[model samples]
Target: MPPRPPVPRLAGDGKGEGTVLQVRRLRGGDAGAYQALRLAGLRLHPDAFGSSWEEEADRPLATTAEALEANYVAGCERDGALIGIAGLRRATSVKTRHRGVIWGIYVDPAARGLGVGERLIAAVIEQARGQVEDLLLTVSAHNATAISLYRRFGFEDYGLDHRSLKIGDGYVDELLMKLDLRPA
Candidate 1:
């Protein structure tokens, strides 16, 4: 398969403030930045993520880079820094190859409300359009912002996993959502 083309700068109401939000799939070389942002997300919002800081904080950059090479990762760059990221991966098993899951979606606090998250998701959907018939994700039942964003993109709740993630002494419920990309 040919390499996917880079994502163009998604339009926003920046006017002339220089808040251009460009979305693109992160490559192997971006592993360091991706790791940093990912760890930050896990730290700042422990309940929002399934992975704990202790588990991934010590992961080597090489391991993260290799993961980037293996998955479809969409990143949002403001100016020159990677402030947001979302990743998608198609199932490898023959019974589930038609499914793709979006994971580790995060945006910096400073970049929120500027459409960065939406653009990241849009890029992922565009990438998944013809490659997979269904896109799936699990979001913490309490993360309203993320849930709303996914709903705007046509994802529908199909089930719920009670106590999906056990963080410290509490459990975080996860809402399973899926978007059907196949047409009638």
Candidate 2:
């Protein structure tokens, strides 16, 4: 197997000056923190995330723990508070092994603008390098900040899912984006 990718160390502005936030592969023990951050993201940015907090709030800890243990990178306090998480799950069929979907990307609002999201995405890209030839994700069309971030990370828009999600009494469009990482 290829070596695990290098972990990203991002700096945060929490300690009066700056402190390094550790980004590492999440384990089963991090399920609660992972769920907490994810739920917070959904609550704060409902249009930006695919899953709703209402839907996920009742998920069992075991399910969250399995997800964290299976395929997730978490950014957290060195002392043990999980502030961000991103996941890459490989497609099931053999022909789809070269592709992976990015999901559950969330960073605590308190940790925003501190490079946590960048570190999380970098970790995702690094992990996808060998296993996947392409990666895909969807973002709310109105999420300009996220779109800009994805663009900076080399993703390109391929299409849009019109009114993909029902929000309030209406709907929101989803911008489909892909990043190709195959060796040339």
Clashing pairs in 2: none
How does candidate 2 fare on TM-score? 0.86
The regions of model 2 sitting more than 4 angstroms off are 1-18
Every candidate's lDDT: 0.87, 0.80
lDDT of 1 by residue, 70-147 (tens): 888999998889999999989989999999999889999988877898899889988998889999999999889889
lDDT of 2 by residue, 77-103 (tens): 534678878888879898888898888
Model 2 C-alpha lDDT versus the unseen true structure? 0.80
TM-score per prediction, in order, is 0.90, 0.86
Error of 1 at 63 (Å): 1.1
**Residue 48's C-alpha lDDT in candidate 1?**
82
Off by over 4 Å in 1: 1-18
Number of the predicted model whose TM-score against the real structure is largest: 1
| lDDT score, candidate 1, position 92 | 85
How far off is residue 148 in model 1, in Å? 1.1
